[model samples]
Target: MVKNQPCIEIFEIFTAKRLHWVVKDKGESWTGQYFRDIILTERVFPFLKNEENVIDPDEVIFINDKAPCMRAY
Candidate 1:
């Protein structure tokens, strides 16, 4: 039996016409380049328009491991 645990440590979402999401950890922000090798490269929303407050630390929560990968595909 495998335990169901979230892979994301922290995350945030900026709700607009579309959802812009960001993930951060260890006090370092994750840029697209940071995920260049990951599947997020193709699926991620380029960059926040006007560079608004996208992901709030308060909104951080646990996300299933497969959600991000499936959403990208």
Candidate 2:
């Protein structure tokens, strides 16, 4: 892994697969984070395109890990 770059652990990736979403055990391992209801991947392109520029749903990893919800345009 390169310095400062994020690396997804093998275990997290596997668990995320089973859950059908991206999983993140951030801050506390016991309490896991789930994202997108489904796995975070290229398929989420539509959702990302309509959303804010800074936050990308496809890039999102954890459930609780999120930015502003319900953008008012």
Q: lDDT by residue for model 2 over 1-73, one digit each (tens)?
A: 5786765532232122233233344532432233332233332323334335324444443332365443222
Q: What lDDT does the true structure give each of the candidates?
A: 0.41, 0.34
Across 1-73, the per-residue lDDT of candidate 1 in tens digits comes to: 6696545644434343345555544544466565544324432433322235334423333233455532222
* Candidate 1 accuracy as TM-score: 0.23
Estimate candidate 1's alpha-carbon lDDT, on a 0 to 1 scale. 0.41
TM-score of each: 0.23, 0.16
lDDT of 1 at 69: 31
RMSD of each: 12.9, 12.8
Error of 2 at 34 (Å): 17
Among these predictions, the greatest TM-score belongs to 1
Q: Itemize residue pairs with steric clashes in candidate 1.
A: none
